[model samples]
Target: MWALDSGICNSLEQPIKRCTAKVIAFDLETDKTVKTVDLSDILKPHSRPQYLVTDYSPNGFPYVYISDAEGAIIVLDIHHNKMYRVVLPRAISAGCGESDVLYLLLVRRPKNQNMVIFSYLCGNKVYGIKSEFLRTGRGSSAIVELGSKTKHSVLLGTDGSNGVILRYRSESELYKWNTDQPYKECNFELVQLAEECRLSTHVAPGGKDALMYSLSSNVADYLNHTCGAGGASARLKYISKECEDDCY
Candidate 1:
């Protein structure tokens, strides 16, 4: 197994001769250093000064996905005890926050095909793409525009077993994709919250909990044991935001 750390050198190599932040790779088996690579050539300047590995594959192969702040991703293939960098597709936006871009390592059941799913935000629009482009580094299929352009957009998690979930400001919707067929339109359902309820959505680790926040009312609703899965039920509880001294 291998791990990656940005802005810090944990490998055996000395300091890299570059102005950009350094990315270090570590071998988890021996807990020793693996190799270090400079981000200057991979990512643009003033971009995300740090990079972290994403769990894209479940197998025992030492494949790590490292991403920068500007929505650019790199695949580090650690085979034969050597590290190689593979450039993946990147998001191009004239204006968009770094947080608006999301990358997920997804797997198709039974066949066990590994693919990277990415969503890029441009203004109020969100585009999703799933392909082997990450592996071959080119010829990625065209981007799929998601829903009507909403005022706000958030790409939640998808475990392949369930479906894809997305939140547009106050509205959350679940999309089901048939993995057996090619890319096409998906079936969707809007998750009900409350009247005129506008909020952001967050899924806890392991998709155990789904959190919905209404900043206007300083309130949050916790959906217990729900991760926006297809046809999965949810339980809602209202909680007041904790203030400096008052809990209301």
Candidate 2:
């Protein structure tokens, strides 16, 4: 029951009410209620709510985690309203594991049209994505979308920021940056309106909606590459034109 805003506490958006108070916690930065906890009607005692509940769901709803908040990691299930807590350091601007593997946060820099990729190591130390000093600046936002269970990348949307997102694959030559080439003419008029961007992939057999970063609403004008598990198998299939059995 962390109420930083004296205003929104009394509102109906919060998790619980007087007769059955069910709110697990509340974040101060993004003023909004986190309901649909993994647990129903269960309660836990905390020394202070303000000490936990960091930034959450600035854009997409129901995707939230309090790092090291629940003595581990706190997973609030939006669909069922249950709370599952896991112990992990919930840093504000980080979402990568030990290796530089997962896709870090990506933002665009307006100054020089560069990108910034925010990464984390050992799950605690925070790192920034840079490419030859052409990336990163202040007041930039970072968004990390998991490309797949084993692969992920940061989509740097903040213009002029040094958080460039680069894609990496196991057992293959790592790819360079994923910046939108200016000279390549876009085909759609709507894509021309987007201020920032994030590229996500999905599987058609899995209904295409269950893929990584599937919660995103933007799916136009970007290269939609199919991801495969186990690099060698994916490559062998690609060489044989048998990609459909895996990709689709």
Candidate 3:
């Protein structure tokens, strides 16, 4: 397993100090760290790094896409021990704050692992680019805007296949969209998983069987009524094959 350590701070209330951070590789069987990569020199001074493991290469090397405070993605090639920085277009990343850039999602295409899709939750469009282009820092024309529309809902996650999961603020059902489909066609609900509690969706790790899961909770009610007096009920559930078929 691999993990990123952003260093320590004085207290929980205080922000993390602008210190050097490390990416550690561990041997699960022996429970020992095998290697460590220092980010002090590669990362900009005082920049904060957020770890995001979304896809892997055809050769099976996991791509570690780290989002920094400056609205740029630091793509780490673990197998080759190489690193590259990816900056979004000015129209998409300009004037974006740390929190705004954190919402950008990167997912690899199931049909073609060499390609990657990038989307922002608040933005009306999605972009696609070949992974090779990012590695070589080549042609800007290689990055293409795949889709665009006046979006009203927020993106939840990917289906781990070709679909992008989304949901309205007031709805309980999840919707999906693919590159080939029109915006209005995305109204089809992938699942009606909850009615009362709020739901958070996640793509299964490693994209196994293209499965997706959700964690539903009534924490809003608990906070409003109990005021941190007790624990709120929650359930972890995966969307099964039967559920997926029924949606179609």
Candidate 3 minimal-lDDT segment of 10 residues: 239-248
Please report, in order, the local distance difference test score of every candidate based on alpha carbons. Answer: 0.42, 0.28, 0.59
Of models 2 and 3, which has the larger TM-score?
Answer: 3
* Candidate 3 lDDT, 66-124, residue by residue in tens: 65645456777777888767766667554445455343345546554445555554556
TM-score on alpha carbons, each prediction: 0.48, 0.22, 0.70
lDDT per residue as tens, model 1, 1-248: 34434454522247452344555656777787677665556556544433343333345544555544465556555443333343334434436675444334343344434444444444434444443344444523544544444354444544334344445544533333333443334344443233322233433223343333222221233233333333332323322232221211
Better model by lDDT, 1 or 3? Answer: 3
Q: Give a tens-digit lDDT track for model 2, residues 105-135.
A: 3334454332323332222332332221211
Candidate 3: pairs in clash: none
Residue 225 lDDT in candidate 3: 70
| Candidate number of the best lDDT | 3
